[model samples]
Target: MNQLLWMAVGAGAVLSIEGLYWLYWRYVGSGSVRDYINEDQEPEGDYRILRKIKTPNQRIALVEYRGQMWIYGNGDVMFSTTEDENMYAEAMVHIPMAAAGKRNKVLIIGGGGGVTTREALRYSEVEEITAVDVDDVMLEFGKHLEAMVRFNRGSLNHPKVRTVIEDGRTFIENTPMKWDVIVIDVPEPTGRYPRLSRLFSVEFYRLLKERLEPEGAINIACSTSFWMPEYFWSIQETLKKAGFQVLPFHHFVPEDGEDWAFCLATTSPVDTDGLRMLVSTEYLTPERLKDMFYMPFYFANGQNQGDIQTDDNTVLLDIVSEADYEQDGNRKEYN
Candidate 1:
């Protein structure tokens, strides 16, 4: 009976030790062993940004994580792989460039990967491209990375392409020249840097409005359709208030779950038929343009209203709070 009691105590002690080890591994030591192995391997498909290269500005080392690529900017995971860099760049750049009709002088804000610049140059109509990125290392990585360079097709070194290492907001504020089209591909707002947050602010959109040519348009990378509904609507509302006729659209990215949203704003009407003439891709079509305008009920319900107090007023702030009221017990309001 004493031996049996000893055996039970021994078993209990072993279980306790194992439980403590598990907790330490799970919370403190590191992630799971599988994650550790994946990190060491740096697998191709599941790329994530492990660290930021601060010497040459805030450039990120993107690696595969959980079957998706994530970009770490300044030790924070800024962007996650929702769609391929090529696909996202193409949509963000091509759509606005095509809609603008003639691309004379283009300005790209926050396209660290150089993907947007690559896509913009695809239109032979473009005379010059001014790409403003805060990180120089991102450009270096884009040049060296076979997949990224191949996808961009050496557009980064195009004759008309001139690289400018500067903050987008500062550049916009100081530059006297107007652009035919402006594409903003900056990080999402975590409310850390007010400049990045300002992109979604009324003042920033107003600045964009000022810099745009009469017929020119702008495209902004909003945010994930799934996670941050309020952030997305706020941007759309702010753009509208800044005197732009805003069209919020989204596409599915396999890396990022569900759907991704982008806001395209213009002073002039978009000639979807005319825009379709420039692209030879399977994605952009007249039919697709028509479909792009059709907002989902959940998204559409968030549009800004005239009376609602919002970050912007010129454009309708889709009253998302009311939508929350309507949703009642069904959905929780996204922060």
Candidate 2:
């Protein structure tokens, strides 16, 4: 009977060790294993999953981390409860507005979580904001998700805001209103993003420029300058083809994990004179703004590496795919 009791205790010890290892793997190791899991698990510590949903359109998740909520969609960080001037969303919104020199009426295309609208609302001169997003699911996240609504500072339902569920190209084609600033805050064109190719095409830029008021400027969310330098160059050339003077700039967004590029294009000359920030920004000093427009000499050497995207010829996807695959290869080699 004593021997049997010792065996039982030994089995319990083994079971306890295995159980602890399993918990560690599930919480920590799972994140490191490639293809081990499709989604992120609830992180350790104060971070907790408030809600997670995988819709046909995209995966939406809300998590509380460091005393704030972060919204992720399709593995990309979308919005966070932390509102700082250095955040990418805030800087992107304010950049074009500053370049425009007027914030009277604004139109935001592909504003997934209403964060851009929230930033735009900081300008009292912004009379109305129309946020057009193709995905109703994303708009619903902005509207129904408590954490998301809080991050957007109630701008989703603000009197100055109007949410429209429509394709950005179609909205620009049909809307009668002209905007002083048009902000394109859509997802990047990489990784199975649907219908984003045409949005980056020359045809789309022409349509966007048509909806801009005279002296108005448009800002497009080009991909990261680090991994996707060619992508930014292609956009600059494409915008020039559409008859707008392009000024390329980049901001390092901590949540994005890279330095993101934004292109400010205008039918008229881009005038920095009298440029003033209506809203306080953390990273966009006047000196920094001037420096952001300068491209490294190496990038300028290969201006025509790829064809500019058009309605008939969509090649931005291929370019982004190639760049991303190269990054994957480098990662594998390092490993």
Candidate 3:
């Protein structure tokens, strides 16, 4: 009996050691999913990785799924690589046309995959588009990624578009050049990562106001209002605190499966009547844009409890934390 007990203890010790090593090998030792797969050979199924970069901010990946490419950051799909007529990319394109009647110089923050800059280039009045992002590898890889370059209609390679590899906050704070249109095509503040929380803070919004021309306008991604109203309200409050007249709007994105919200803000009131959708787009029209201003009853009155995000305090991060979303049934199980 004593010898049997000794053998059992030894087995348990070996199993424990193996488990710990397995954990380390699975996460720390192996870099990313891309590291395990061969570049020349196609991945198991229809999905194929075009490019993958592990940035300090997040793990960025360009994945091809079912013949379509997707830009994913930190396990969340930011947008589709293919140019879908009914996607958010189309709606965001019309923002410059709707807000800034004359687009001369535009600044795009977090315009990954180069779609936003592509959309902005459609305006004949637009002269230059500067896109800034933190991940240098992703930006460099985007230049060569066939799916991304083609989807943007070669806008990434256009002479008018200038790409900058730097943190969005630092770039905006240091830049002296003011912009006619500033588009914040950033990721949603889901609090899965802390680095993204600062972008939605009141301090950042204030910085954005400083960078805009007197006649300039800004576009912000407020996330989906379908199941998360607090997230939308928090952004509105922060933007208002930064001293801008905010116009909140929502549109149902087919790829997102939720009513995503965006805010058009300027120092002065935006005359929607005078605004015209000069660029032909599949998603946004004059009639559809009119309905975006009216918020649904449930979405407008949801229980939004959280602190206002500031430079010192990232309250928005706590509001949309992945743990909280998991508990609240807001996040899908597979996602």
RMSD of each candidate relative to the true structure = 6.4, 4.7, 7.0
How much is the lDDT of residue 159 in candidate 3?
Answer: 93
Q: After superposition, how far is residue 252 of candidate 2 from its true place, in Å?
A: 3.5
Which wins on TM-score, candidate 1 or candidate 2?
2
The per-model lDDT (C-alpha) reads 0.65, 0.73, 0.73
Best by lDDT: 2
Off by over 4 Å in 1: 1-59, 64-70, 74-83, 191-194, 253-257, 271-277, 301-335
Better of 2 and 3 by lDDT: 2
Cα lDDT tens digits, model 3, 1-335, are: 99999999999999999998887774467744534232322334767666677777776777777888766776666656654523677666576556764589999888767787788888888889998888876676557777777777777688999999888989988888888898887866554467777788888999988888877888888766354566777787788788988777777656636687888888888877667677887767778777767666634624543346787876667656643546545554211
Cα misplacement distance, residue 167 of candidate 3 (Å) = 0.5
What is the overall TM-score of model 1 with all chains considered together?
Answer: 0.72
123-209 per-residue lDDT for model 1 (tens digits): 877899988877766666555555556656666777888887777778888888899999998765432233355455677788889
Clashing pairs in 3: none
Candidates by lDDT, descending order = 2, 3, 1
Q: What is the lDDT of residue 166 in candidate 3?
A: 89
Score candidate 2 by lDDT: 0.73
**Model 2 CA deviation exceeding 4 Å by range:** 1-47, 83-86, 253-257, 297-306, 331-335
